[model samples]
Target: MKKVKRRAMSVLAIILCLMIGVSVFTYRFFSQGSQWVNFTANKHIYSNGVLIGGAIYDRDGNPLVHTVDGVRKYSDNESVRCATMHIVGDKKSNIATSLQKVYADELMGYNTINGTYSVSGTGNSVYTTLDADICAAAYEQLKGKKGTICIYNYKTGEVICLVSTPTYDPENPPVISADDDNYDGVYINRALSSRFTPGSVYKLVTAAAAIDNIDDIFEQTFTCHKTEVINGQKIICSGTHYEENFEKSLNNSCNIAFGNISRQLGWNTTAEYAQKLGITTAHELSGIPVVKGSIATSGGDNELSWTGIGQNTDLVNPFAMMRVVGIIANHGMCVEPYLVEKVTNSSGFRTQLPPNKTEKRYLSQSTADTLSDMMRSNVRNKYGESNYPAGMEFCAKTGTAELDGSQVSHSWFVGFSRNEKYPYAFVSFVQNGGSGAKVAGVAVTRVMTAVKEKVDSQSTAN
Candidate 1:
C-alpha cells in the first residue's frame, strides 16, 4: 500500500511538470514570432528610406527657403529651421498641419519622440523657377511700408516669390485670438485673406467685360470728374479725368468711366469674371484653408457699378489677382499655383509627384492679348519715361483702393515681365499707402530689377 501511494504521487508530479514546460514553450514561440513580425514590418518601412521634410529649390539647385548654417548640415534629420518659417509653415499648425493628413503614409516613417515627424526627405524636392537672390533682393528693397509682392511663373503657375508685409514668421506665428484686436496678427496671409476695394485695378476687368459684351465700348468717350450720380448716390473718380475714351480712361484710372462700364457689364457679368479668375467666393487656397473666400451676394445696379469699379463689397487676395494677370500672360489658360517640387525620403530616394493640373480659361487668347497691349501702353504712357526699362517690354496696372470713411487706402500694382525672352508675372500692394504707382511701383521695380539681374547672371554663367 505504501509503494502504491508513492508511485501515484510521482505520476502526479510528472504530469504537473509536463504542463509547466508546455506553457513555457508556447509563450516563447509566440513572443519570438511577434517580435520577428514587428521587426519585419518596420524594416520594410525604413527600407524605402527615412522620411523627412520637404524643400523648395531653384533650377540651379539653390535652396530658396534657406537653411540654418550650423545645425544638421546634410541629413534632414537634424537640420535647423529654414527661412520659409512663414512661407512653408510648420507641421503642427497652419497650412502644414492640414497637409500632413494628406501626406500621412509618406510622413509615417520618421516619427519622432515629440509626436511630430519631419517632412523634408520623404520624396521629391520642390523646384521653383524663382531666383533666390532676386527674391531676396526684392524683399530687402520692400521690407518696410505696407505692401505685397508676388512673382509667378506664368506657364506653370509656380509662385516664384510671394511676400506680404508686415509678414509674420510661420515657425513662431502670433497666436490668433478670438478678440477683434487680434485682427492685425491674424493678417498673416494678407495676400490671400484681407479684403479691399480694388480701386483702379477693376478698370482692367471693366475694360475686358465691356469690350467682350458691348460693341461700342471702345468707341464711346465719357467725361469723368469729381463725381457721377448712380442711383442718386454720388460715385467719384480720383481726379478730374475729364472726357476720354476707354484706353485713356484706363490710363487715367477714371472711376466714373469704369463705373459706367460696370453698369453695362451688370453685376452678373462682373461676378462671372470674378468667379472665372477664382476671386471672391470661388477662389481656393491651401494656406487659406480648403475653403472659398467671401464674396458679397447682395446684387444691385449700384452694387454692380461698385463691383465693376473694384469696390462695393469686392475683396480678393493678391495671389488671386496675380493669377488673373497670369491668365492674360499665358493667353487665357490659368494654371494651378504650386510651391512644392517633389518630395524625397531620407535614403535620398526620389518620387515624382503628379503635376498640379492647369484649370479654367477666364478669357479668350485674343482678349488676353488686347488687355496685355493696353496695360503695356498705359505703363509706358504714365511711368514709362522715368520708370520704364530701355530694353524690357512689359504690361502693368496700378490700383489705389479706398477704405470707406477713412483716409487710409490700399495701394496695388500688377504686371508681367516681357524681358528679352523670359516671361514672369507679379503683383504688389501697399496697405494704407497713398499712391499705388509710387508706393507699390517702387517695390515692384526693385524686385523686377533683381530678377532681371539674376537672369542675366545665370544666362552669362551658362
Candidate 2:
C-alpha cells in the first residue's frame, strides 16, 4: 500500500513539471513571436521568392501591392511601385525594410488556431492611410534627391503621403548579397529612420521656448551684425538682419536674433520646450522604426546660442518634425502618427488600427494660437508666399541646417494648412539639399497641392 502511494506521488510531480515547462514555452512563444518569424526561409507562405500575403491597399481602396500567381507584385505603374515601395516594402529581406519583416507573420495571415502549423490560403490584408497617387506626387517632388516627405491629417492623425526618395521598384528589387549596381539605399525608409540636421526650421523650437518662458517675448527686439559675440564665442548669421523684432526676425530667418534669445532663455529652458515638441524624444510608431531627435545642450554660451537657432549639433528626424507641426495644427493637442488603418483576416474579420494617443499636452492652446499667428504671418511674408496657391492660407517654417564639413545644408520645411476641406500637416527634408525654402519647401508645396486637389475631388463626388 505504501509503495502504491509513492507511485501516485511520483506521477503527480511529473505532471506538475510538464505543466511548468509548457507554461514557460508558451510565454516565450507569445511574447517574442515576431523574432521567431523573422527567419522567412522556412515559412510556407513564401514560395519561389514571392510573398504570398493577402494584399496591401491605399486608403482609396486602390491596390498598391498584391500577390499574383503566388508571387508578390506591386502596381503596374513604375511611379506607384517606387512611391509606396518603402512603406509597403519589397520581397527582398534587408535591413532597410524591417517593418516588412516585423509584419511578415501578419502578411502571411498567421493565425493562432488555423496557422499554428501552417498559414493557409492568402495572408491577411493590410490597408493603410497612405494615398498611392499622393505618395507618387510627393516622390516626384524629391526629384532623384535623397529625402523624406510625410503628410497626415491633423484632426485624425491619418498619414496620407509617406514617401522616401532614391527608392526602387518593388517588382525588380536589387540584389543585396553581391556588388549589385542597382542597390542604392532603395530599401531604406528615410522618412522614419534617417536623422538629419534640421537648421532654421528648429527655430520653431527656440521660438516656442521663448514664447513659453519669457514674460514679454513678443515685445523684445534684437540687433545683429551678421555675427554676435557672446561669452567670447562668435555666433554667425547668414546675413546682417538689423534691429529685427521677434516676428520679422523669424520670417527673415535671422540667426543673430535667435542666438540672443537662446542665451537669454538658456539651455534648460530650450530643452524643456524641445522635449514638449518631441525633440530628443523617441516615439514608438507601430510597425515602423522611428529615430529620435536630439539637441546639444552641454556647451557654453556659443553652443547654446548656435543650438537656439537650430544649429550646433542639432539632429532631427523628419517624422518628428511632422508631428511637431501636427501639434500646432491640432490646436496644442498631441498627434500620434499612424499608417495602417485596418487589417482584415482570411476569415473576413476586420480590426481597425487607429493611432494610440498618450493624452500628453504638447503645447497650450494660447501658446499654439500665438505661434500660429506668427507662422501664419510667416507663410504670407516669408519664402512660402510664392510657392502656395493664391488666397490659400497656411503656417510654416524653414530650416537650413549646415552639415559637418559640407557646403550644402540639410534643408527642412514644416507646415500645416488652414483649409477646412483639407486639414493636413506636412514635413519635407532633403539631405544636402540647398536652401530650406527652395529645395525642401518646393516639395512641400507640391504635396500639399496634391492633397488639396484630392480632397476637393472627393468632396465634389460626395
Candidate 3:
C-alpha cells in the first residue's frame, strides 16, 4: 500500500510538471509572438460593425485613437498623425511597426474569464507614456531628414520624445505594395528599427573597458596623427593631436588614441563591456521592436583598433545607442522604457502599470560618474557650452560615422542633461549630415531649449 501511494504521488508530480511547461510555453508564445503580427491577425472579428478594440491615449489622457460610429478614428492634426504613426499604427494593420497590433489583446479587452470581447469593447483603454507635443517638436526639427531623435528621462525611464522619419498621416495612409520601398509607404520607424555606424560615440565602450581593467586610466596619454599606420592599415582621425589624456582624447575625438587604447584592451574586454552597456543586444521596450546592436567580437589587431574607434562591422541601433548613454546618466542602473502606462477594461477594472524596472546593473556608479565627467568635458572643450540652453549642465559626445565613399557620413550626438528639475538622456542621428557638432549637436540646442522652457512653465503653473 505504501508503494502504491508513492507511485501515485510520482504520477501526480509528472502531470503537474507537464501542466506548468504547457502554461509557460503558452505565455511565451503569446507575449513574444504578440510583438509583431499576432495582434491584428484576427481583423475579421472587428469587421461587420463588431467593436473589436478599445482606445489608446497619451500619458496626459489625450486620446490618440478610438472607435466612433463603428470606424476607427485618429486625430485630425496631421503633424500628430505623422509623428505618431509608428507608435499608434493604422487600423489596416499594414505596417510592421503597428503598436496597436502588438497590443490587440488588451485593446480588444479580451477577457480571460469570460473569453469574450464585445463589439463595443469593454472600454478598456491602453494609456501610452508618450508625450505628443514632444513628438511633434522632434518631428519638426527632423524635417527632410532620414534619421531619428529621441529623449527620455533616464531616472524615470519615461520616453519623452520619439520621432522617426518617412511617416504619413494615419487619416490618409497610402497603399503599401511590393514595388514601393517605404519611400512612399512611410512604414519605417528609423528610431527603433534602423542601425548605423557609431563612429566615435562607441569610444565610450572602449573607454569604459579601459577604466575597469586598466590602472588609473585617466593618467594614460596617447599621441594621434592625421593618419595612423598599424598592421599595414591606415586609421584616420579629424586631425593630429600631439598628446592627450583620457578627457582630452574624448574632447578631441582622436581616432588614433582610441585605436591604440582599443588594441590595449583587446577584443575580449572591449566586447564584454560593449555587451554590458547594451551595444550588442536588442532592447525590450514592450510593444516596441528595437533592432539589436552589432559588433565584431574577434578581429585582427588593426581590425580591432578600427572597431574600437567605432568601425569594422560595428553597427549600433540608434535606440540602443541612446540607452547606453542613458545607462551612463542613471549611474549604471536604469529602468526599462515603457509605453503603456495603464490598461482599463470595460468592467471598470483599471490596472495600473508598474514602472518597467531593469534587473541588471550595467556598470558601477563610480564608473558612470567618471564617464559622465569625461562627457561633460567633451561638451565644454569641443561642443561650446553656449550652444545648449543657458545654464543647463549637460554632457555630450559627437560621432561623424563614415559610410561608403559615395555618401556623406552620418551625424550622431549622444548625451544627457540633468539638473534639480530635469534628468534627460538624448540621441540625435542625421543621415548624410554634416559634422556631428555643427549639425546633430546644434540641433540639440533648440530641442533642449524648448524642453527647458516647457519644464519651467509647467513648474510655475504647478
Clashes of each: 21, 5, 2
Q: CA lDDT of each candidate?
A: 0.63, 0.79, 0.78
Tens digits of per-residue lDDT, candidate 1, 65-172, equal 323331111213111122232344343334332233334343333322322233543333444444455545555655555556778778766667755455444334
User: Which candidate number would show the highest TM-score if scored against the true structure?
Assistant: 2
- Of 1 and 3, the candidate ahead on TM-score is 3
Q: Note the residue pairs that clash in candidate 2.
A: 199-401, 200-399, 200-400, 201-399, 280-293
Q: Native-vs-model 1 lDDT?
A: 0.63
How do the residues 1-462 of candidate 2 rate in per-residue lDDT, one tens digit apiece?
999999999999999999999999898877765555445555665555445666888988788877777767778778888888887777665545444565666666664444423234666778788888898898889857888899988877788988888777777765465555344565678888778778888898888888888888789888988887888878888988788889999888899999888989988888888887987787766667688888986788889988888888888888998998888877788757878777877665673354464444688998887787888889888765767854447789988888777468888889888664677889998888888888898888987887788777888999
> What TM-score does prediction 1 earn?
0.75
Compared to the true structure, candidate 2 yields what TM-score? Answer: 0.91
Question: If both were scored by lDDT, which would come out higher, candidate 1 or candidate 3?
Answer: 3
RMSD of each: 10.2, 2.9, 6.2
User: Candidate 2 or 3, higher lDDT?
Assistant: 2
